[model samples]
Target: MSHDNSAENPKNIDRANNAVSWDNSIRLFLQQAGSSSPTPGGGSVAAIVAALGASMTSMVGNLSQGDKFAAIHERIAEIIGRMNRLTGEYEQLLHADISSFNAYLEALKLPKNTEEEKTLRRAALHEAALHAIEVPLRLMESCRDGLAEAASIAEECNKNVISDLGIGVILFEAAAQSALLTVEINLASFKDEERKRSFEQKVSALTQEIGELKIRALEVTRKRIAGDMA
Candidate 1:
């Protein structure tokens, strides 16, 4: 008899559907997310939120194009390209978040009847948990970078869509906070104090920076929308 080993490999797991959450419509994604399954939880939701922020940034960039805005057309084009790429990266992070969590679930199911089996299970769980943390950390980093790009284009994008840039910053802020919570939860599984503290420090700094960027971006957005940017 031949045995299949697909389930043993996290990369081989079926992520074809959930990875592209927007392709099936947000309604369907929300339905599945609200189901009893726990795969597409906070982490996946954060990725979607961040992606929406990037999309909003790109939307503003696209609106800022044309001969009327020829003075900064090249810079706006570059911003649009960067925002589009960030959107794609966030979508990929959705897959990574789901897979990493599922990998932890698989590790949890490993045999623990003997000392050797228990040792192996512990190691697997440790690795899986770290990966889970890494996914959210990456999401937070992407949110920071995306917000920076959004802020950069806030004053330069079309005045008609200035509010959209603020909306993007708000979304990015929420996603970063959500991802931070996920990272904190995963950090609970770590037995090494030094390693865990390192992650804590990193998340703290990221959260602070994200918050500052949100404030700056929103200020620009408000000033532009109110015609107060003298």
Candidate 2:
């Protein structure tokens, strides 16, 4: 729940996660974010938003269980469990994003006055940049799994809550895309051509999978809503 953000200084990860409730924490985070301080920035927000989608998927799964959809009883349980796990992963990622960036920021502050200092700073920066790249990379993978689970649960959950599935699709799509953008930025900065290629491949794969799952969920959601009306 709490972590020191940077190796050198306490970063925003601790400051952001200290609130009493998720909703209150979001409110407090947003207020702090609106300031000049740049700790709980876009990466954290993306994970938080994706967490909302994952939590909603769990809600739908829990509510859709019982006699009404007994055929999917076991499946619902599994989906809810997956969503809970994804939710927890995203929670930790929210801090990881901030911590990674904080590490990069700390590297940037390294002394650059001497030739030796400059070389050391350069090496440290490349290391930190890789860390920065890695956080969003894992974030994309988490979003990838979260979106896939959302698609699977869409067809099984209650029609009354069908609309939340659509929202989940949108959030998952947004989360994946946002995380991809972050990775792309770091990929550009990172000096390892092979690692950049690997990251690029993941971005491509995650984008495709996230897209297909979102479309599949939307189609299923529409049919279910129409069937309910009929």
- Candidates in order have lDDT scores of 0.80, 0.76
Model 2 lowest lDDT segment of ten? 1-10
Clashing pairs in 1: none
Clash count list over all predictions = 0, 0
Error of 1 at 98 (Å): 1.1
Superpose all Cα atoms of candidate 2 onto the true structure and report the RMSD in Å to 1 decimal: 4.9
lDDT (tens digit, per residue) of candidate 1 on 98-119? 7776676677679999999999
Model 2, 1-230: lDDT tens per residue? 11223444444434433322345565687886676555566777778878888878888888887798998899888988898888888878877776666566667678999999999988887887887778877888888788888788787678889888778878878987888888876677668899888878878887888889889988888888889532
State every prediction's TM-score relative to the real structure. Answer: 0.87, 0.84
Candidate 2 local Cα displacement, residue 62, angstroms: 1.1
| Candidate topping lDDT | 1
Error in Å for residue 171 of model 1 = 0.7
